[model samples]
Target: MRVKITKTNLWEVALALKILHFADLHLDTSFARIGFSSTVARFYREQLREALKRILKLAQDEKVDLITCGGDLYEHERYTSDTGKFLQGQFENIERIPVLLVPGNHDPYLPDSLYRRLFWPSNVKIVTNAELMPVWNLGEVTIWAFAHLSPTQREAPLNEFKLSDDEGNIHLLLMHASDMSSVPPGKPVHCPFKPEEIHRAGFQFALLGHYHQGRLSSLQASSVNVQESISAPGYGYPGTPEPLGFDESGHHGVIVLEIGDGKVKAELRPISQFAFVETELDISTATSRDDIKSQLQYWADEARGNYAFARAVLKGQLQPEIELDLTVLREAIGSYFRYFDLQNRTYPAYDFSELAEEKTVRGAFVREMLNRIKLATGEEKETLRSALTLGLQAFEKREILEQV
Candidate 1:
């Protein structure tokens, strides 16, 4: 007997193209700018390599149709031949799935770049063009990509390019461009383009890089939950698969895109083993170094600090008699965390009223500063308080360090 399939059943059986997207692996980074020791730097570099292996394994496990790398796969200046061999082996392991790469500012497509120097797997495709160029046409989907030929690529590849026709197929853009609308503070724009440009280019979605923080555009919400399917034509940044620095503090992962039935859904799969955490610690009631250590320990325990690279900004008033030795504080709780950093922004706790009443030069100075502080408001008040602290430090023969 012959069976007829209903429209709903046909839709259920429709092919869904799954693409696993990630960017900014930045393998072999020295980590020196973040003040990491050589040993720690090497450890982080190894972590990046491991992250790549995990990403490949996830793609295979998910049975993704394609794997896309937005860019900055490694630090061109520091990437060794061994790293290239490692990447080659990892990609070759998933030879059944096609891999697409676009070089970014940090790992541009220079003549000596690994992209050109190494013999990548036959399934891997690297976009070497400095302009928008179609690299793959997978029957139902066409991927357009570009590379940063120089370390300072600033050309906007999307501004002038537009699809001639949709041809009833999904068009995807893969590039390491900066979205001007959501550029991170202190981040330089590279291959800059606006969000509207993605729509103007007539693409279903643009997988992006250059922004360390993952974000989505053209969606009702700015971010998405894991495996929460939503039909939308948008662009997104998968961000770095691992935290490169303290500035990149949120979830670091890969994006899984499923396109079928004329709808596209992106899901974030968090795969990073390490985390970068920043928090503020108020030591207003603390009277000793042990108190600070205890507070840090408590926070570490609460945060599951085993794999955390943490930074605590010490704020609020600190007792005058208790001098904060950052080294001691870090040593006290350093073992509790993988890495710990302390930034002092504390103000000295002073009994202003008592100091003003004393019969001494210091007393007179304190009295004058207190009078000024009372008259001041807003920033002026804070400025006077800082001056008072500095003056007191000078009188006490204590070293005055600039507050961060």
Candidate 2:
């Protein structure tokens, strides 16, 4: 993921340097996009292309000497050859400045892989080994990086790295790793390390990649080491150079870092031309189709973001005669936003009084159900109501329980 930067403050007296820090650019193949339905697939491609173009232009405008990418450059190992060729062309645009990358879990280095086999530009350096590889140096500043290409995903206690003198030199540590707690529940468990340990490794700044959402500041635990002077700069996750899915929304871009004479400044640049907006709407007052339509219209109008792909959670009580048409609502939102998910959470308007007085089979069933609900404990009643609600949904094609 390469973090993008448009501008930064310049140091007046000292020799200062600017670097564009980005990471977790999982460039998936067009084939994978096709699996997401045709419209969705095309949307993904557009975001990816726009993000790449933005970062390349940002680098040139910032006059960055080095573009440091944390890791996860590709989505997976199965991208088409044309994808590699396209990346090669993009790399050529910034061939004047060195682009340093460390492989992340998603785009791990494999034997005979396209990343390893392809002929990259001379300015690009792929750090595949685990040892500290000193690559970039200009005017006494050194970029010490460790590429985690080991079979296992996690690296910690960055013991191999010993910062050079703090005088006149900016020591930056670069790698791809996720904080232990941030790993998604079911995803493949990649390398996880404590941020505190990495910070205390004596480096002035520890620029990281892997976790998608951008993170800027953190503190090192006292247990790691006491020798380092400054707390590490936990830069930002470049996110995906593009948005992969609905969850992958909000400020999708890179970070630009300015390090000069022991002082560092970090800024976030948003490249996602499209916005993924997820909002909740209470349909408690909506009685007819037109009422719901007006509410939807207001929501679409209220969508205030760069690009909108919103999902409105429609909740509350629904009228007995009213039935929602999901297809119509999905269409009504239109291409103003790429996608809008109208989730129905409303309960049916059931008249309990009418059923209580009857003696028929259906009436008896309703009476007994009500009696049990009134007599049972709160926990027991809630559990039973859940079962009945699901059963009713199966029978009526909509919710029946009243949510309070």
lDDT of 1 by residue, 303-331 (tens): 75678888889999998767678877777
The regions of model 2 sitting more than 4 angstroms off are: 1-14, 29-36, 148-152, 157-168, 180-189, 218-234, 248-250, 304-306, 351-404
Clashes (backbone N, CA, C under 3 Å), per candidate, total 0, 13
Q: Compared with the true structure, what per-residue lDDT tens digits does model 2 show for residues 175-268? A: 7766564564544545556555454554456677776665565454333322212334543455666665556645567777776655666667
In order, the Cα lDDT scores of the candidates are 0.82, 0.65
Instruction: Flag clash pairs in model 1.
Output: none
Worst 10 residues of 2 by lDDT: 1-10
Alpha-carbon RMSD, each predicted model: 6.7, 7.5
- RMSD of model 1 against the true structure: 6.7
Q: Which stretches of candidate 1 lie over 4 Å from their true place?
A: 1-15, 219-229, 350-404
Candidate 2 versus the native: TM-score?
0.76
TM-score of 1: 0.83
